[model samples]
Target: MSTARKHDPISVQDYLAGEAHSDQRHEYIAGVVYAQAGGTNRHNAIATNATVALANQLRGTGCRAFNSDTKVRIRNAAGTRFYYPDAMVVCRANPPSDSFQDEPVLIVEVISETTRRIDEGEKREAYLEIPSLAGYVLVEQSSLSAVVYQRGRQSGGDQGFQRSIVSGLDDVIQIDEIPLELTLRELYEDVELAEPDSTDRS
Candidate 1:
C-alpha cells in the first residue's frame, strides 16, 4: 500500500504520536503511515466472534487476546513495521507496557476486498518473519473459508510451515500454540456471511 506523503518523510515517533489521538487508525511502514480502511458490519462481527472464542478458552491460561486496536511490530528487510491484526493471541504471561505487542503466537485477519492482496501477500510474509508467531490465519468474509499457515517440523529435521484451507463448518483447527480447539462454526456463529457471486468457482 503506497501512502501519500504531504512533505518530508515522517519519523516513526511522529507517526506514533499522530496515531495516539487520531480518530482513524493507520499502519506504519518504514517511515510512512497509511490510513486503514473502515470495515463492514460483517467484518467486525467475524473479528469479534474470533476474539470471543479465543478469550473464553484462554481464560486463566496466562494467554491474552487482543483486538484490532493493538499493534504488532515486526523487523524485516524493510525495517521495523507495525500492523494491526483483527485478532491476536499472545502467550506471554507478562508483556511489555508498550501500546503494541512484539511477540504473538497467532495473528488473525478478516479479509476484505480492499486489503486482500496486502493481507495475503505482504502481511503474510511479514508475520512469518516473527519467530514467536506460530500461525497466521485469514478468514474470508464472503464465504465460510479460512486459510491457516502454521509452522511445522518435518521428520527429516527441516523446519517450515504448512498451509491448510478449511471450508466446511465441521472443520476445526488444532493449533499447538493454544489449548483450545477452534471450529468454523464458532467463528461464524451469530453472523451472516456475504453471499458468493454467481460466477464464483470453488
Candidate 2:
C-alpha cells in the first residue's frame, strides 16, 4: 500500500541518498519508492508509549529499542524491501552503524484501518524472513487488541512462527526475542480509547 508519493524505480543508493535529506519517510521496495503515511495522534501515542517502555527496560542492556526513524532492511521472496516499523529491538553485539537495522530481533507495527491488511498479511510474511527476528507484533489502533507472530523455540529453523491474538487491557505480550514483557495497559497508557461495541467482538 502506498500513500500520496511514489517514484519510478530508483537504485538503492539513490533511494538512500534521497531519504537522507527528505523530510518525509519512504519505503524502498525493489526499485519503487513509496511515501509513508502520517499517523494519527492515537497512533503516535501508542508508538511512543511502547518505545519509552521498551527503551527504559533495555537500558544498561546490549539490546536497544529503536523508534520509527530506524529502517529495517528485509530480504524476502518478493525482493529486497526496506520498512520503517513503529518500534523495533535489535540485539546484535555490533550491529551495523548504517541508516537501517538488518538484524532486528523484534519488529512492532501499529496498524490503522488503512494499513491493517498490509501489516497483518504482507508485512508479517516479509518480516519473518529475517533470521534473527523472533517476533512480529501488530497493534490495532481502533480497538484494544494485538496480534503476535512468534517463532517457536523448538521449531527447526525460520519456519516456526506461531500466531496469537491478545485482547483486553489486562493482557500481556510475552516477547520471545528479548526477555521483556509488554502489557496492553503499558502500551496504551494515557491514551483514551473508545468503548467496545457489542457487535465488534471478533
Candidate 3:
C-alpha cells in the first residue's frame, strides 16, 4: 500500500464518508489515509482460499467470515483506524448497518514484499490490542509458511500471546478460539508461489 501524498489529515467521520464513495480502498491510520494497492494473483488466491475454508467450517456456528472488502475498525488511545484485513472471522456479528467490524476473533493477512513490514509490525501490534482478537496470522506468498500469534498467558504469567511458526504443506494451523484448523495445502491451492531469490539472506 502507498501513502497518500500531499493529503491533509482527515477526521474519522470524513474518512469513512470518503471511503464509502471511493473507487479504491484505503486504510485509515489516525488522521492519515493510505491507499491500498491491488494484490497479485497468488495473494488474491490465498486470501480467497482461506476465507472460503473458514466460511465453510463456520456454517451453523453463528460466526461469519469476511473478505478483504470488509473493514476492521480499531479504536485506541492513539486514535481511530480502519484496516482491511485479507480475511477475518467474527463470532460476534456487527450490526447490518455497520460498515466495519469492531470485534474480530481471528484476523488473517497474506503478506507480500510490499506489505511485509507493516503487516508484521504496525498492523500486528494494533490487531493484538483488540480484546476480542484471539489469533493473528501472517501468511507468506513466497513460501508455504505462516506465523500465528495466539492469545495466551506468557511465561511471566501475564496475559499475552504465543507465537507459532507453521511451515510445509503438511502443517496446519489450529485455532481453538474459532474451532478451526487450516492446512497450508488448502490455503495455497492453485496458487503459484514466487521463486526464492538466491542472493537474499535473512
Candidate 4:
C-alpha cells in the first residue's frame, strides 16, 4: 500500500489571494478558512431590514452601506483577513481597487444557528482586527437581541473591548463613524422569528 503525506493548511494570505478564483467565499480565522452557509429566509429578511434601515439613515451622510454580498478585508497580527458582512457602512476612505470596501465604519452580521458560534467567536474577533473598525454588530435570528461591540480608541489593536449588547428592540446602537443611531427593532422589522413553545420542557 502507498501512503501519502498530507499538505499544510492554507494561510490567510493564500485565502485572500485566491478568493476571487475560489468557488465560494470563506471566512478567515486563526490562519484557517471556513465557508459561510447560505442563510435562510428569516436571516435574509433580518439582514435586509437592517441594511435598508441604515441606508435610509445614512442617505444624506457621506457613508455608503452594503449587504452580505460585499467583501471585506480585516487585518490582524496573524495576517490580513476577509469576510462578507451582513450590513456594512463605509465612510473612511475610497480605494483604487473599487471592488470591495476595505475600511467600514460599521459592520453587522446577522447570526444564524449554524454560523452563530463563528460569528460570535471567530468572526467577532476578526472584525476587531481592523484599525478603522469602530463598531461590530451581531444580529440574532432566534430572537430580537443584537450585540454591539465597539472600539474606544481612535486607532485599532488591542485597545478596545466589547462595548455592550443592544438586546431590547427599543435600544439603539450609536455609529460614531458616520454618526448615526440604529434601533434593534428597525433591524428586525420584517423578520419573523420563531416563538418559544410553552410545552417543550426538557
Which candidate number has the best TM-score? 3
Error (Å) of candidate 4 at residue 33 is 4.5
User: How much lDDT does each candidate structure score?
Assistant: 0.80, 0.82, 0.87, 0.72
Give one clash count per candidate, in the order shown: 0, 0, 0, 0
TM-score between candidate 4 and the true structure: 0.77
For candidate 1, the per-residue lDDT at 197 reads 36
- The digit string of per-residue lDDT tens for model 4 on 5-38 reads 1213677557667676876566654566666556
Task: Give me candidate 2's TM-score against the actual structure.
Answer: 0.89
Off by over 4 Å in 2: 1-5, 93-97, 155-159, 194-202
TM-score, ranked from best to worst: 3, 2, 1, 4
lDDT value, residue 191 of candidate 4: 65
Ranking by lDDT: 3, 2, 1, 4
What lDDT score goes with residue 17 in model 1? Answer: 83
Measured with C-alpha atoms, the lDDT of residue 151 in candidate 4 is 72
lDDT of 2 by residue, 1-202 (tens): 4744477888888998999999988998888898886776777888999899889989998899999989988876677889999999998833455889888888899876667767877788889878888899898876888998888776565557899999999999888658888889889998866333211111
User: What is the TM-score (0 to 1) of candidate 1?
Assistant: 0.89
Instruction: Indicate the residue-level lDDT of 150 in model 3.
Output: 88
Candidate 4 error regions (>4 Å)? 1-23, 28-33, 93-96, 153-159, 195-202
